[model samples]
Target: MKSSKPIAGRYLGYREADRAAPYARFFNPELAPLAPHVCAALDRGGVPDILLPDIDQATTNLFGGEAVLEDGFVLTSDGGMRVSVRSAMPSVTPAMVDWWFGWHGDAASKYKLWHPQAHVHVGWRETPPAGASGRVLYVGQTSIVDEYIGSDLIRGAIRFVPPATLGFTDKSLDDDQQATIICAQIGLGDAPIDIGYLAHHVRAVPGGSEMRSRFWMGGRHVAGRNLIGGMAAVVAKRVLSVTESDARALLVHCAQEMPHLASFLPELFGEFKDAE
Candidate 1:
């Protein structure tokens, strides 16, 4: 259930910060406001109903091969949907957000640390049941390997909470308002880490959807925490700088596979029009 290996990596040579900083607080504020905006924007447009073929190829290209997903689905008694996808990516990097959003580029690759055999369990149910909560759960394997840390596997879990729970109201929201906020905590097996949190706001645009993720790493101490934390920061910064380009690449790949979605390509890459 938990990683048994000791935290012995060469990257642990750096001195600890003079003062430990506060965790969780860093990401909550910024992401709180942005979640509503993103959800509203997405509502105005629409969530893309991507085909299974598109998803399969996009996932394959995202990891750069050496990955496969198992098929399985389950239904909860509350009429919710539960999907389990097991994947094995031998060349996975430590850029958790980029990996989660399917971003794989030179910048993303620079943060490569280790490969992981991950099994993700996703569960979600619909809303509008009156006072119902819109949430989802994602649990998978976590690991970072280098000459110093070797190869110790860690279990990670993220829970997505509804924006309404955070005091967000649907008043003035568009009739198709499908916007939502996601607050996720990264944990090692059953033990939660205070080093940082993952906040992502996803919205539907004209042609496709847009997702912005902010990872705030404060100060937390766990086994091999410092080493993994440092690597994550490096990777996060690199991915953030090239987010537009990464989004374009992902869309282009999807378009190439599904020609019908090509028309939305321009809209998806609109933000990067000048860059091109």
Candidate 2:
């Protein structure tokens, strides 16, 4: 290599002496000849591991070195490892790394635009038409009233449903009886189902008044605008993580009470046939 300046000449001058020493030892005179060039290379952009001193001692203790040096290459106690100085760069902003690892990117991305679809209960002031139970399955658009109901459920839209009244005497609405009633309501319908209803919450939001109230059933929740979708999404994610095919197949079973949705389950989940 051509010498760039007096600094490079110094390394070239010792080239012959460094050549005489063992290549593996740090003090090898032959290799010492290239130390300056190595330093220069590191200044430009090189792995500091090469420039680390006392290979024998530093290798044993990455952190146990001359007390004078606050930071430089790191050596493990066993003397078998060496690390570059770049590892310290993370101290500048720890949160950046934390955010990258901590955020649920995959889950958030799936439902940010719309909550995941999950099952929901719908009740009529009057009983669903006799033998018309299958039509009860429906999918609805996202709405705050639905979301609010999903949160606590007691003070929200569910109150108008039978599960809130006939099913539960506690008035809390979370009682087992109420939940069973709700589950039964979900069972009444099938997939690819749509229904219309008056939206009580939309009028409060600007431009919401113009939007008609309707529900569509297939993917998940009956209420579109509520947290119910989020809850269902979480469950689905968990199930899919373990067994994609099994999860998709089990979703088909969700339509037991609602045969309409179940009838089309084969089509909706057919794509996952090879998930295993």
Candidate 3:
């Protein structure tokens, strides 16, 4: 419910020279052209197709079998929202995908590179150990981010977790070359309250990988960051009303940002994989 105006001002504190100094040429405000399938997805928008309670089944569906809905959104029966999006990462590797999640949270400028037009800031609550990197830094960490999901600029606490923790199997998760899943609990920036869950499944194909992302918001996943937050979560649904418009914006934002990030992530990771 907070406006992005003050949030924008808060993180706009970083100097462009200092922030872009490392990534230098990679910081681009203009977005790369979206993949053709992404373009078609934008045009295919319609009514909410999946229920929020169906999120468990939907999550199961994406785990092993063919996906149920690649790019879509729905207003759940429980007054929540469900969103799905698929991005074909032509040359991005699973390792790079994991690395980006760990690295981008350290700074606003680095976060902006993922979606220059939308991302405003990223700051970690507690950074991983001194030598930690890759999935090590991400799986047990939280990143507070401010970004636009359409016209609405929003702030989120993206808390990453292990694939196994989110129900991914050993078989499905065995080989990093085969697949890598990034799972998270989505929370509010100010309050210690989680409102949703998200999984971005990146499966290796011939040349690159594909990211299948699903989000369940404002329903069963809702929880307080602590005991009090947990108690408050009981009425979370009544107070936090998620609308069809919110769902649509979420779909559009994901559709645009994922592929855009995929375009440059591989190169960015290769360059900064060893740096802080």
On lDDT, the candidate that comes out on top is: 3
On TM-score, the candidate that comes out on top is 3
Residues 1-276 of candidate 1: C-alpha lDDT, one tens digit per residue: 123443343222112331132211111111111223333432333222221112123323222345422222222222221121222111222122222322111111211211111111221212111111211122222322221112333334333434343333433213223333344444343333323344333334454443333332222211234566456544433332322222222222222212211222233323222221
lDDT of 3 by residue, 65-171 (tens): 65365777777767777887788888988878877888778878778777777788888988865445433377788889888877776778998988767777747
Off by over 4 Å in 1: 1-153, 164-178, 218-276
Models sorted by TM-score, best on top: 3, 1, 2
- After superposing candidate 2 on the true structure, give the runs of residues whose Cα lies further than 4 Å from its correct spot: 1-81, 87-92, 104-276
What candidate 3 gets wrong by more than 4 Å, as runs, is 1-4, 8-15, 18-20, 33-36, 39-42, 46-53, 130-136
Against the reference, the lDDT scores of all candidates come to 0.27, 0.22, 0.75
What's the true lDDT of residue 126 in model 1? 23
How many clashing pairs in candidate 2? 35
* Per-residue C-alpha lDDT of model 2 across residues 89-165, encoded as one tens digit per residue: 11112222212111111122211111112212222323322112122221121111111111221112222233222
Question: Positional deviation of 264 in candidate 2, in angstroms?
Answer: 47
Model 2 residue 165 CA deviation in Å: 57
**Please, what is the TM-score per model?**
0.27, 0.14, 0.88
For candidate 2, give the lDDT. 0.22
